[model samples]
Target: MEFVITGDGSNTLYHPEIGEHYHSKHGALQESRHVFLDMGLHHFLAKEETNEVSVLEVGFGTGLNFLLTADDATRRSLQLHYCGIEAYPLPTDVIFATGYHRFVQPATWAAFMQNYAQALTTEVDFAEHIRLKIAHEKLMDFQTDDQFDVLYFDAFAAIHQPEMWSDQSLAHICSYLKPGGIFVTYAITGNLKRSMKALGFTVEKAPGAPGKREMLRATKVG
Candidate 1:
């Protein structure tokens, strides 16, 4: 594992053999805000109204997505089951060193960060509305027996991690999505769109979040 500081002192991580990359570039806090909160949660809220929502995230780096999702669940008083997969997880020091609280509010940041740490290292409910479970394995190793209402496919860009966006993974993901379930992602590569289409998804190009022109959201057709 190698780490580099982005232009703004945010951390970016790379795993050479595993073909994984994470940007703490905006910090994990900012990345989650832009990628998951702004892109995933915003889109989810606009389309659905449910007492409970299931979310599956592809890359569980920094636990930022989980924190944000848990916070939303608490705010909306909605039940949330967040399932994520990560082959390699960073240590707590690496996570804390990124200075997530600097971007997020200080009060909630401590509680959120504590939950985030406990969620990664243990499998238990940290609160009433939110449950976190990490597969602690490659995404490909996980079976698609359980379907989710939404999937946050915030993997590294297709260019940076091609295998993670392959047809096989898309197929696996589709099998885990209910009909009409939505999958949101930050990458807008043409090959990725084709792969999702091949896996029986009705793909759409959605408005991108910050630092990008467009993102992808594919729906499973009933």
Candidate 2:
């Protein structure tokens, strides 16, 4: 395996030897789909307008979230304006090595992967209503003039990527949110919650997926 995967191989989807990170024994994809996509994304879309939803995702990771979101948007026939940031990008070979195809169909997965791949080298429109712009830079240096209705803070776990979870960085992200905008993440640390509250977010602890205690979903209230 190109990357090392941790936790039990059965529970974890990616090859432990090939994956660079792990959220639970169930694997990173399981964690992301369950926590962020199913719980967070589904929740956000339920109460908001999807004709055009602006999204900001930190730690783009393997772009699984983006792909899922894109597919959802296409399925829903909604417009999507996605902006994501990442410091270190994994190679396409590495990403494919994770066996994403096993979940997504071959044809559909190929189209999805192509869009994701094209996103890296260009900021272009995938479809009439779908546009993707990625910043191949560290989150700290990323500054956007646009406001987002939803933010997916998918940085590494606090223990591994402490800098990405700092109050200052979160505050910076909050500056670009529309009033009542929502921010979701798998982290629910005490300090992180306090920091979010300090930044003017009304925080709520939601039911976390298996193997996790709680996840955070906060909204920026005017």
Candidate 3:
């Protein structure tokens, strides 16, 4: 795994074996804030009546998404139960090398790193509003009866990890969402949109984060 700086000055890991970056080369922070934070979490919070929100993230590569969501949840005063599934967790060295902590307030970063140290071992309460549970397991093998109000599908591109973007896999993941739950991702492929539709999601093509044309947001319509 190589740490490479993205266009937005944020770092992302490049897996040479898979030939995929953990985030958009355009901007890791930009992509996460746009697709996951803005489109997924905020969108869910806006429409949902509950003070607490449940979120499941497909790829927890560098914990960027979780950290960003935790920050937002704290600021919004919304309780967030965040579950992140990652088959291969990055080493602490790689995570530190990314310099993600430099981007946030010192207090927030400190809390994030403290929880991150025990991320794979147990659920960590980064803040009163943010409780994170990291599962070191493949998404396909993950089992949970808890349903989510938001799903951040930040997996590698369908081309690199086709199984992750397959109709069967998407359908399976969608089963974990509550009705009217929001789903967001950086991938905006035609086949993916169709697959979401076939699975009963009302899909929308949202403006991409950067260095891309568009992204996708879908809602489970029941």
Q: Rate the local accuracy (lDDT) of all candidates.
A: 0.73, 0.74, 0.87
For residues 1-222, could you state the per-residue lDDT of candidate 2 as single tens digits? 334453434122332433335345545566777677766667777887557788888877667777777777777877888888876676776666665566654554676566766777667686677888777788778877799888888876776667878887888877888888888888798998899999988999987766787889998989
lDDT of 3 at 122: 83
Each prediction's TM-score versus the true structure = 0.83, 0.85, 0.95
- Report lDDT (Cα) of residue 104, candidate 3: 70
Residue 98 CA displacement from its true place in model 3, Å: 1.3
lDDT of 3: 0.87
Off by over 4 Å in 3: none
> Pairing residues by index, what is the TM-score of model 1?
0.83
List runs of model 2 lying over 4 Å from the truth.
1-22, 105-108
Candidate 1 to native Cα RMSD, angstroms: 2.9
Model 2: how far residue 52 lies from native, Å: 1.6
Clashing pairs in 1: 24-27
Judging by TM-score, tell me the better candidate of 1 and 2. 2
- Candidate 2 has a TM-score of 0.85
Tell me the number of clashing residue pairs for each predicted model.
Answer: 1, 8, 0
Give the residue spans of candidate 1 off by over 4 A: 1-21, 24-31, 103-108, 111-118
lDDT of 1 by residue, 23-135 (tens): 54434445566767666666676788777888898988866677667777777788888888887777877777655565544644676556655666666675666677777
* Model number with the top TM-score: 3
